[model samples]
Target: MKKSLVLLFIIITHQAYSQSVAKYSNEFMNIGVDAAAFGMGNAVVANINDVNSGYWNPAGLIGLEDKQMALMHSSYFANIALYDYAAFAMPIDDRSAWGISLIRFGVDDILNTTQLIDSQGNIDFNRISLFSTADYGITFSYARKLPVQGLNYGINAKVIRRIIGDFASSWGFGFDLGIQFKHKDWKFGLMARDITTTFNTWSIDEDLFSAVSDQIPTQDLPETTEITIPKLQFGVARSFTFSYDYTLTAEVDLNMRFAETNDIISTSFASITPAVGLQFAYTDLVFLRAGVGNFQNENNFGSESLTFQPNIGIGFKYKGIQVDYALTDIGDQSAAVYSNVFSLKIDWSLFR
Candidate 1:
């Protein structure tokens, strides 16, 4: 049965590969949802556990004990943008688990300068309009342990919505699949994201663009479609025990975007995106994480040095409750610098 399922997935992916991916349809979905995961440079594919696994790698959810719930919130890019996430997970019988989660990213009160000056030729600050852009998604996730002991597989179904004030909006749907294999202190993982080629059919009218075209050229525009290319993530992790009181886990993940073979780079596979993360824990009470990733090294120091992605996080777990905090880079330190992420988790054992 697993073989058949795998074959079906391959066929569907092959069919969707012909379509081109667009920009910003469900882009918020790419932001790391968990503080611990983000602190590790978004390298949780093989090192995931807890409720946030619903977004990182649902396959990791099967390992969760009892029922769990988590909540997270953060502000990005100097507080101009905000992100929030929540999830719940519980085991089903002995071999499977189910999870549900939601994510929201928004930028509020953006100034619209279309009507900066009034007809009377006097500058009017009131004429400046404020609007918002928001992207939201709800996900249903399931994970099951394979008959082969240490192997697990999972899937996620997502419903997404994007809004830009009252001017434009879009609705989209997508799916993700993941697998994990663990051997002693080592683990491996793979994730197929947007497997069916997530696409958003935008609803836009000329009225929204006609005004801006007056300054440039009044060219006709057609309907627009936003497509999200399928992405594959490969990860591996190893745990090292320094002593009975302390343990450290190191992990790395590689991201390959299948649709980019034909894009602006022209070369097949283009460049690889590598993420590395480390976690230090004392028994099961406290955890510290540091990571760096998402670096597109163009080999030019001047331009490449400008790209920065780093994170640090700490967590505390006691009596089935966990609290985590992370600080991640947002932009250049000169302008808007960093973002803070906080999350809380409650395990069923505490309630029992």
Candidate 2:
């Protein structure tokens, strides 16, 4: 490669991977999944106590005593996009458990505008069509509790797929590792996401995309290949009971991305994001939660990025069934910024 051209390519790559651009592979994998987790500022790494743990820290499933399942749905970015998740867990033995989970996110019935032009350079409304852009994943998890009570470990293997109308698609595979330890009334958790590094291989219909490019020759899309960066999260949680039947749990978590300033991995950290959450429960039946999330932009307001958002949620349980709801204030970017999340959890043993 020529020296000058190589320099240009390097610059472009760095800009594309910048925190603001975030053109990361399988980016959808990072979606804040369930209502309970989202309610706690996505800081459930150590506070997970339900089947939804399959998506956060699978090790949290080691204590399961009954067959459990959960379902969650969210209307993100107002009502323009939809996100759904479901998971089922079964105890394999006295101290071992397995779970399967699926997540799907999509923007449905999107009008395809590329083919809106007619042969006569005149307006033709019929040329426009509707299509969907979707992303999905399937995960298998296994967790085991060590002979030393309260010590557990888990691993997850997952397959991911993304589709953009009928023009492009990508498939990816990745693994996650987690460890959890509890002593007295405190819990500690560690999770390594994408331990083996996720790879997304894209297939684009050259002819179809070329047609769109020809419509406007000034700009073109970049290559579709992608490699996701690995990140680590650590969390601690503690509960305090004040009254006879009321208890409060507090949690703190730190997320670190192992990338350098140039978006390259190294010993140095690219960013360290911190979050805090609090949950109040009444006799383990009704719960209220609130938290703050994504404050990484606070240090760099000049970047035109959002600072942080407030999360609020409430849930109740009856007869071995749990229901949860969460509302996230996504700043003033748009009236549709608020996100609504709902989730339901059930223990099959209750019926048996």
Candidate 3:
């Protein structure tokens, strides 16, 4: 029975063991951090300026006035999976800034049923074990103001680690580039992720893998190497102030992938997803945000329909400490699993 289960798992992951460029490789890293960004439909690429920017648009780190830190936790699939993130950033002189961030997404305490039956063909209740499958990402970022006025640029070096309950593990590396420009109340930004093509090399435990091969006489095993292609995000934003106390900001973003997808705009060469976000503020203390994104064409049976994900959030800020909450969807509206996201950000300047 244990061998049978292992065979099933191997069959399900057969394609994953091949050397290829997967469209959804390293997907957890793209989930985005910070409830504020989630509440704003991830459209703040143009105007973001905080510790969280290390994941969104590193160039925005240049906006940090002092040391800053942020943390976030969210659960998905009804709490079966947990996602956590933490980041720190500080200004470097007046022309440059640097930041570091860590992210983890995992399903914990999974029962390892492969050992449920003992070698003596007897049921061994104590043979069962617990393990976890998790993915971790660490990013180092640096940003500097360009010689040209109102322009800033940033770069990121990323290391990725993945583990599967001692069954398999992998290591990967990648790079990202970002640029942000501000002119008056208008902002523009561009982000290029996996610019050099991230690659993951998987090292499978042969002792564990052989257990499956022993069950099947004609099975071959091979090492796996996965690749992630480049993706680009472009954004524009503007802020409006009224009555000396009221403010509103609006932003638009375009996400472009290299291959055809279910996005609203698709071609053989590329696909584009558009997102729009709005924020209303009172003296920059209290805030309300709403946005919609993840446009896709869902096909039910033989019919197709358009759907999107909508998000709403609120925030409170006092003396450089901010708390934000967002109600967002893990997937698009077509098959949505709503999740509540909360995040906290602190400006160390207040303590200094």
Candidate 4:
């Protein structure tokens, strides 16, 4: 009874806090995957491992006892197709480990347009430019077991690139720092990512323009737009075992972005999300899992004006290989019903 009440209080507090900072950028990269599974519950950062850890919490590498490699991909309802992620991790010794990862988010065939008018009062057709947009990041990571029993610390550096049509693109760099501690039955985790701000500039060419009206001739104009990524994410989670094979866990996350006076957009908004999950393991050979997340408003659309109110997922494991899948709804739009994600993971180690 008391425990249930405490859980309720925590959920309410987390929901209120999350509403305060609902506006942020690079949402495609941040939305995450392993739906139906990770989405069903609030994505708890501390427990993350496998390939997703490259994007969630780098410190999780400390808990990995073996060499691991993983990949994940998803196709959203719209014509949008997400690419894949791959990661490899190996322990140097009992106390230290190192890893590398690659993540790619891609979109297919977008229509290209140019500002032009023909003599017959008709629009001039510019050659169709079938191009795609991609966001790729390469990351290097290291983690060490701390002197304090179950405590671990780690960091990761990432080089990021964004490519649009022939007209625009950008490159940037960032870093993430993380720590985790476990005592008895309690666990805690923290992560600070995207420590550096990145930007991209585009130059318009004069040849791409044509005459518009009688007096005004279309001229290519050069302009630059800069996007500032968010910084710092904090998470905490707890797990309890009800039986030898059944366990329940809860997790919460907070993303913080300090506002800059010189920036056109303010970063005062923050997002607080909480998640709960159930895991059932059968004789260590097979496992079943389910989780749900962000049950508060369940309808509030943040920066994208797209509501991502709920998510669910499942996973299976055999020997050293594991597979996971998730489904999500990014709200229904006039053009399409948006959401979907899939993931695969593998871990191998030569123990001493």
> Per-residue lDDT of 1-352 in model 3, one digit per residue for the tens?
5765566456434534433456667888888999999998888899898998899999999999999999999999889989999999999999999999999998898766676766787888788777787899999999999999999999999999988778888999999999999999999999999999899888878787665566544343434778888999999999999999999999999999988899999998999999898999999899999988888998889999999889999999999999999999634474556789999999997796
Off by over 4 Å in 3: 1-19, 214-223, 330-332
Per-residue CA lDDT of candidate 2, range 92-144, in tens?
A: 99888999999998888866666566667676777777777788999999999
- lDDT assessment of candidate 4: 0.56
lDDT digits (tens) for residues 1-352 of candidate 1: 2233224323322232224245223657887787888788888899787788899899999888899999999997678888999999999978899999999988888666656655676777777677777788999999999999799999999998877665556788899999999999899999888999787766654585544445423222222566786788899999998868899999999877753331223246443577889999999899999987766434354553324477889999999988989888644321224789998888989988
In order, the Cα lDDT scores of the candidates are 0.76, 0.76, 0.87, 0.56
Query: Highest lDDT: which candidate?
Result: 3
lDDT of 2 at 332: 46
lDDT (0-100) at residue 85 of candidate 1? 91
Give the Å error, residue 224, model 2: 3.3
The TM-scores of all predictions, comma-separated, are: 0.82, 0.86, 0.93, 0.72
RMSD values, in order shown = 9.8, 6.3, 2.5, 11.5
Model 1: what TM-score? 0.82
Clashes of 4: 22
